[model samples]
Target chain A: MTLSITDVTKRYKIRVTRAQVNALNGVTIDLPAKKTLGIVGESGCGKSTLARMIVGLEQPSSGTVTWNGEPIFDKARNMLSSKHSNIQLVFQDPYSSLNPRQKIGDSIAEVLTVHHLVEKDAVQARIAELLTEVGISPELAHRYPHQLSGGQRQRVSIARALASQPDLLVLDEPVSALDVSVRAEVMNLLIDLRERLGLTYIFISHDLSMIRHISDQIAVMYLGKIVESGPWDSVLENPQHPYTKALIAAMPDHTEVGNNAYEAPLKGEVPDPASMPTGCAFHLRCPIAVPSCSTNAQTLREIEPNHQIACQEVK
Target chain B: MSKPLIEISNLTVSTTDDNRTLVNDVSFSIAPGEAVGVVGESGSGKTLTALSLLGLLPRGVHATSGSITYGGKDLLTADRETLRSIRGNEIAMIYQDPMTALNPVMKLGAQLIEVIQSHGGDTSNAMERVLTAFSEVGIPDPKRAYESYPHEFSGGMRQRVMIAMALILSPQLLIADEPTTALDVTIQQQILALVMQERRKRNMSMLWITHDLGVVANLVDRVIVMYAGRIVEVGSVKEVFTNPQHPYTAGLLASLPKASDKNRTRLLSIPGIPPKPWTVGESCAFSPRCSKADQQCRSSLPVLATNTHTDAACFHLMGDNS
Candidate 1:
């Protein structure tokens, strides 16, 4: 595994006088070394924050983040050693990811300069190589972010991320803002890059169809916890958790309708995050909820050969 | 056969900025109890066409030359009073972001009640009327929600409130302008399903302006693909999705990852952004981007031609080139 997160948790103190709520509670997962791991959840699911922790942008409230089986939170050690240099992140909005004032070549060269990988004379040549690596012309390196299109801007962002030569890239909805018209092109670019560079990815998104197309493994998050985790096709086709089922069924694709309320056409609303349900966080709207779910919180357990679900009613 | 609900003839809307034309001689119509979707990239004038109906242009654009005839009455020629009645009471609209569209200070009940009363509906127990519409849109705890403000609701709930307001008057025509653009995928489904269900139950005409073809495929019956503020293609949903004639429509649909898709390569992108008004032509505007554009296409403006239920605005569409 290239990335292993063990018992990661984040808790935010409530303002306006209320008890603190746990956003992520004891989450653990392993992302294999060259395989893309997809994290699926709605907004406020703490997936992005977890991503921030993986990339060393945000410190986790409590727990350990292991990159290449090495501890990341050890402050003095991380600063002294270059062991944590193998992980990087790519943001959702390509337009904002770049520096508008600086040329695209300088934006990429700045990273290489900071890392002390290349000399000043070799920086321009490296910029040309990086630009071509992401499938953009070397001439585009002199252009501004605004001058480039969305797809081109995204390619520049990928080039910048690749300039560090990271083993894993934390992708936070990289294609969410792009037009559905260009979604496949961008996704295919990522696949091709992974093959050529041998980079692992932690792809986070709210779009199920996009997740299914790219991910090797899938994790379904409700509130903050991942209620279900398993291989992609099986988990999406036969979701064991009710929350996963609702999210999948909510998608208006070419889906065959099931008779149960599982395909009940996405009624009601996702509950408030401030004051969550007492037991199972999803029981308030779970179509398959039983009497036990309202009182006893369910733990994620393997229900099938590889599928794990966190629902009391699944049994 | 169904009668047309609205017919826009040679619609030419020009912006006030230096007499620049936004929509040039665009023509299409919506039939009663039919939903027509308009698809395009951002700034492609899709929103401009929908805003033309309500005269909701932001103080700088105007319909220079067009006849927006609705039920034998030219909306372009209607007086302020006549358009006011049609704008809200008869022709209701729901905007993209309900949280922003709704007044944050006002209670949802008071806001919905105001729409109902403004439309000349019975005003007694106005809050009850608001709650009933909320219930109709499947809002849970409608009574509690009736007393809540816009901020108190979630993103999806805020949209439901907007839908309730849009349908409170039960208008003859509903124009939902990107209602689910701000929502999550699941919430978007809930919102679309609610709006579609309400429209079907009322048997009202709908003009859904959005960019999601998957959405239009599920909700709308027909589609109108627009570019540079002109109607490029108008046809049945199945006809367009299955056999897209225009290169733009085909590219848009092909780029989207279908629900049943396995893995594939070579997703066809149109190479560049949609043409700006300055770059648009007197002839075929899409000719520049179309791989199949010929000498005839570059010299003449393509017209919307229909063979059976399939219609498109391309000269080479007759040659089975899609």
Candidate 2:
């Protein structure tokens, strides 16, 4: 099944000041069946907000998110419909995501029981199978979150997500909290699972290296806008947007030592989401911005067959 | 090397009550104006080693035996008064989280002034110095940032403020413990550039501790790899990254997802989690997870020895001949 998010915008209203925080501004993307779409952005760029909207955790303020031509949210009930269960989200911090007091097996079992995916009698066996699928020992099912290491806790988180048998998995920085070695293990597991189960993935991370490893398609986000989108190789090797180029350049390469000096591209930090810059959201930090860039809004336009960029200066 | 700026020899730090060793027999030296990067994973004792240098070990943890000599004086044995004089004047430090390091209630400018005044620095034109330091670190608007509190600034700006405060005294040495780990890649590049600029301007020595090998390769001249509270490998950045001698170093390098690897092969991950501090024994601490470990490796510890391209503490070197 295909997942389409069209012009999804999310705004959070500040309680005290009554000011609106523009989290996601007109985010639009389409993911075909069993394809991996990677979203890369710095903090406060609305990547996570888009993930939440895709998984039906939060409804969009102004647009629609559909799965197989059906809206995921029910307008009458004002909540997620039954079809939303096809999408599951795995968070970055495994320790906070898993319940501290509950046993690992119990957490997985709770998901299975709520979804009624397995019978009551076969619950224990199903739990064992799930644990084994994620490379965890079935014997440790009784262990609490504190007793397991970070890697094991993350495996349990994955197992819980798989209990729903989702068609789409939105991984929000799944391995960012993990160490490098353990991050490899989790990433490998994800690649294996996607192949075996024919799963669609929407991976979000700030790390370009990790994104390049698993993504088939890539989207670069900046201040609640997608500035670049294309095949992973095209977007990474010959980046079009200035922000994307800076991100690729800033990525530390061990082999390039002594040859390249550290250059800070795209000066200054990301602007505040509440009071975004006038025209292009990145005009404030764009190194090649013209005077008209401050007044003209930019939209994604196809440069190549499948590659798209949103910058005005890149002819 | 022109008189090593700081030399640590046989340094061992342990918890006072349990006598559990956290950093065991770790030793390295940073020459004057040289930048050294200490690389390790969590619980690898890299931070503890850096902390011991500044005499900032947490409560209940004490250096059991070692000598941290700086400029012909043993800082480990120095008195409180001498340490107080040397702390922010001759040596400065910035941590991973600037929010916690800074006082949230105080204005950024006032806090920086306090650091100068507490060190008995010149009181005249203190505001000017603070603003100058702020501008040097690329605070955009030094005057506006000076009046802002820690909570008001973003993560990147706060780290710049921390770097500004750490460099305000123009210390001879700066010990940065994962200072850019929490920042975005773009902001991290900015901070690294700032640190490089300041270090070059002052000819200052630096001990940068981080888990990222890519960051180490980009920033530091020399690299020291630590695992389970011991130095696994030591060499120049080019030698270590190009030709790693230790198995752990090789595994760490292999585990990183390289952008140049167009094939998208599976990452080579280390088998198990790092051993807890108390579980490390007399034998090679990484033997349990190392694929090349033998009975001899499990029975005895290996000291640092010369290898092909670097000095490594391993019975089975990766590319060694003879």
Best by lDDT, which number?
A: 2
Candidates in order have lDDT scores of 0.80, 0.90
Per-residue lDDT for A1-315 in model 1, tens only?
A: 568898888888788766676778778888889998899998877788888888876666888888878765554246434532677789999888899898898899888887776788999999999998888999988899999878789889999998878888989999988866567778888988989989898999988877887888999988878899998877987887878877877765622221112224445666767777878988877777777778887678998876788886777
Quote the positional error of residue A269 for candidate 1 in Å: 2.1
TM-score of 2: 0.98
* Retained true contacts (fraction), each candidate: 0.39, 0.65
TM-score of each: 0.93, 0.98
CAPRI band for model 2: medium
Identify the runs in model 2 with alpha carbons over 4 angstroms from their true place: A75-84, B320-322
Encode model 2's per-residue lDDT on B1-322: one tens digit a residue: 7889899999999999999988889888999999999999999999999988889999999999999998788999998888888888899999999987899999999999999999999979999999999999989899999999999999999999999999999999999999999999999999888898899889999999998888878788999998888899999898898889899998888888988898889998999988876687878888999999999899999999987799999999999422
- Local error of candidate 2 at A281, Å? 0.6
DockQ of 1: 0.40
Tens digits of per-residue lDDT for model 2, A187-273: 999999999999999999999999999999999999888999999999998899999999998898876765526778768889889
Off by over 4 Å in 1: A75-84, A254-264, B117-122, B263-266, B318-322
